[model samples]
Target: MQWRNSSRNYGLTSILLHWGVALTVVGLFALGLWMRGLNYYSQWYRTAPDIHKSVGLILLAVMVLRLVWRWLSPPPAALPTHTPLVRLASTAGHLTLYAGLFVVMLSGYLISTADGRPISVFGWFEVPALVTGIPRQEDLAGDVHFYAAWALVILAALHALAAFKHHFIDRDDTLRRMFGRAKY
Candidate 1:
């Protein structure tokens, strides 16, 4: 089904950004878990952490662009007959995801900066340090980053499950609106 806002379902740009961010977030999560499992002195562990930081900064930049795109092009219309509770839940869930993601990225950057490490953006560019001192800030930022990461995982899982429910049980076009209709 064509989405309500525009003549087409999700525009090509929207679909690309959505899938790109999804893949990046999932990869980051797995990398994070792997890095956490390694010993601090392990060279492999060091590499993973640096890669994670670099990829995360890239994700942050993409997310900013995604936000701008979203503002310029709102999501496809929701079901016309959603109950008030469902509407509230949807709004809360989306807001939580956006806020949590922003915080997670910011905390990661702060953590790296606090540790006196320059954040490399996808190995192409470096983000300048925000602060030079405060080791304790790094510890606190680490805690915040982990907490936000867990929250993001939970939120993303729920969002995906909800999409599946709409597609399979509700037999709605909600998922297809984002993914587009099958070519065949």
Candidate 2:
């Protein structure tokens, strides 16, 4: 597959970033949910958080790359079959997805460092705290991260449903566009 996008379809880089970010975000969410349920005696209570912080940092890196890629190579145009409203909504949705990803990661970082601890990424290196010494800052970050994450969940679901709608209901190549199978 081509590495760069064309007017007709998204290139491989976009597709990989799209699906890769999707998986990592979902996995991180699942891990966060599971860690919350752990009892004090559970080994994972300690280990899980370390893993979460490490992977979340890696995900932040990937998200940065994805954003840079998107800026350098915007995706192909929205499906020509879409109406004016659909086009506008599509643009908004895309922007929200990108912004949400950034906010979620940033908030996660804040929550991790709220207690004045450096984030150790798999012990290879440490990410210095973004914020420190603010009273109850972690608590505020926790709340923001929670709500923003839920919002991202809703938006991502809607995005997926719309893709399925176009593919199954509207009989279009919306999903395939990212795979570079769309005809010119």
Candidate 3:
């Protein structure tokens, strides 16, 4: 595959980022849920937050790079089979996905630092509290994180369903395009 996207198909970078972020988000979601259920005595209870924060920072960085790459190398045109509304929805959906990534990551950061504590980056360095000493703000950030995460879950489900619809019902190349194997 080419290093950049073409009118026909996605490039290696896009495919890698798309799949990588999808997998990473899934893992993070499971880890977040699992860690939440842990008791104070559990080993991961102490480590999980740090792990989550570190990985989330990495994800935020990757997402930034992905956005840059996207701007540098535009995606293929909407499928011909797509109606005007479909095309609009596709555009809006993608924008929502990008926005959701930012929201989730930002809210996670806010929640971590909401307690007026610096975040240690996996024993490497520290990220000082961006929002400090406001319990109400912390609580609000926590709520945003929770609801935004679930919204992301719903959006992802709809995204997957739409991809499947294009493949199975619409018999289009929407899914295959992302795989960097679009014959059309």
Candidate 4:
């Protein structure tokens, strides 16, 4: 597969990043939910959160890279079979996804660093707490993080359903394009 996007199809890079980000986000969300149930005496109590934070930090970096890649190699235009309402909804949905991702990540960061401590990513590096000091920062950010994460995941599910609708119902290449198998 080609490494750069074309006007008619997604390239290998876009395909990989798309799937990578999707899988990572879903995995992180699951991890977060499971870890929440761990009690103080659980063996995974500390380890689970450490893994979550490290992966979350890495995901933030990957998201930045994904945005830059989108800027560098624009995606193909919407398929002609889509109606004007579909096109507008697609655009709005994409923007909401991006916005939701950032909000969730940012709130996670705030909650992690509310005590003014840096986040250690797999002990390889630390993301310094640069924006602490808000009153009840952790509580407030935790609420935001929880709600935003749910919203992001739900929207992503809807996005996938729409793609399936396009492929199975509309019989279009919309889903195949992300898989790098569309007729460009």
Which candidate number maximizes TM-score? Answer: 4
CA deviation > 4 Å runs, candidate 2? none
Predicted candidate 3 versus true structure: per-residue lDDT over 83-184, tens digit per residue: 999999989998998999899988888887877787788989887787666667777878888888888878988999999999999888899999998866
For model 3, give the 10-residue run with minimal summed lDDT: 130-139
- How are the candidates ranked when ordered by TM-score, highest leading? 4, 3, 2, 1
Q: Write the per-residue lDDT of candidate 4 for residues 83-168, one digit (tens) a residue.
A: 99999999999999989989999999999999999999999999999888999999999999999999999999999999999999
Q: lDDT for each of the candidates?
A: 0.81, 0.87, 0.88, 0.94
* Candidates sorted on lDDT, descending: 4, 3, 2, 1
Return the lDDT, model 1, position 177.
68
lDDT score for residue 67 of model 2: 77
Model 1, 1-184: lDDT tens digits are: 3322354367767888888888889899988988888987888777898899988888888999988888887776666655688679888998998898899999989998986778776578789887767759888999999989998989999999988987788777767867766222
TM-score of each: 0.88, 0.94, 0.95, 0.98
lDDT for each residue of candidate 2 in 88-133, tens digit (9 for 90 to 100): 9889998999899888888889988987789999999999986877
Error of 1 at 136 (Å): 0.7
Scored by lDDT, the top model is 4
Better TM-score candidate (1, 2): 2
Taking every candidate in turn, the Cα RMSD to the unseen true structure, in Å, is: 3.1, 1.3, 1.3, 0.9
